[model samples]
Target: MQFLSAYAAALIVFGILDAVWLSIMGRLLYRPTLGSLMLDNLRWAPALVFYFLFPVGVVHFAVLPAFAAGSLQTALVNGGFLGLLAYATYDLTNYATLRVWTLTLTLVDVVYGAAATAIVAGGAYGALRVLASAGWI
Candidate 1:
């Protein structure tokens, strides 16, 4: 039950933050740079897969460890590092292989990923703590 609560909190936080980021950046950033490569419509299946699975990664890698250590700082730092690695994997690979992938985009995305993941992990950890205190989780 505790694990599920943590996972759920992480998923919700990550999903909300990522959705807002994507919606805002889709025009200001991605469209200007990667518009040519952009699909007319989103492919939801892969996106859903990523959204669902990434939070599990966060719960396992960041939230649980932070809980074990009883430190929110652990969540933020580990989550940020995980985000850096994960986003760098995608952005760097694209920058390496795709002619359209700009260095600016890669750098911005990697930074965003790190910051966003840190926020998500911290938010989830905080939420779990509050819920536990309230005897809700």
Candidate 2:
């Protein structure tokens, strides 16, 4: 029950944050930068897979550990590092292999990924703490 609650919290937080980020940055940054490479319609299958799976990684790598340690800082730092590594892998690979990929996009996305993941992880941890305190979880 506790694990499910934590996972749900992390998933909800991460999905909301990432959706907002994509909605905003897809116009302001990605579309402008990637232009033709930007698909008119999103590929939902892979996107859904990523959204679902990413939170599991977050819960396992960041939230669970921090919850055990009873330290929000642990969640934030570990989440950020995980985000950095994941985003950097994608962005750097694209920059290296794709002609359309740019340094600006890579840098912005990498930073956003780290920040967003940190926020999501911390938010989930905090929510769990609140629930536990309230005897809800």
Pairs of residues clashing in candidate 1:
none
What would the per-residue lDDT of candidate 2 be over residues 3-105, giving only the tens digit for each residue? 7787899899998998899899999999999999878999999998998899889989999899999999999999999999999999999999999899999
**TM-score of each candidate structure, all chains considered together:** 0.96, 0.96
Q: Give the Å error, residue 62, model 2.
A: 0.3
Q: Positional deviation of 120 in candidate 1, in angstroms?
A: 0.8
- How would you encode candidate 1's per-residue C-alpha lDDT over 9-127 as one tens digit per residue? 88888888988998999999999999789998999999999998998888899988998898999999999999999999999999999998999999999999999999888988898
**Candidate 2 — which residues are off by over 4 angstroms?**
none
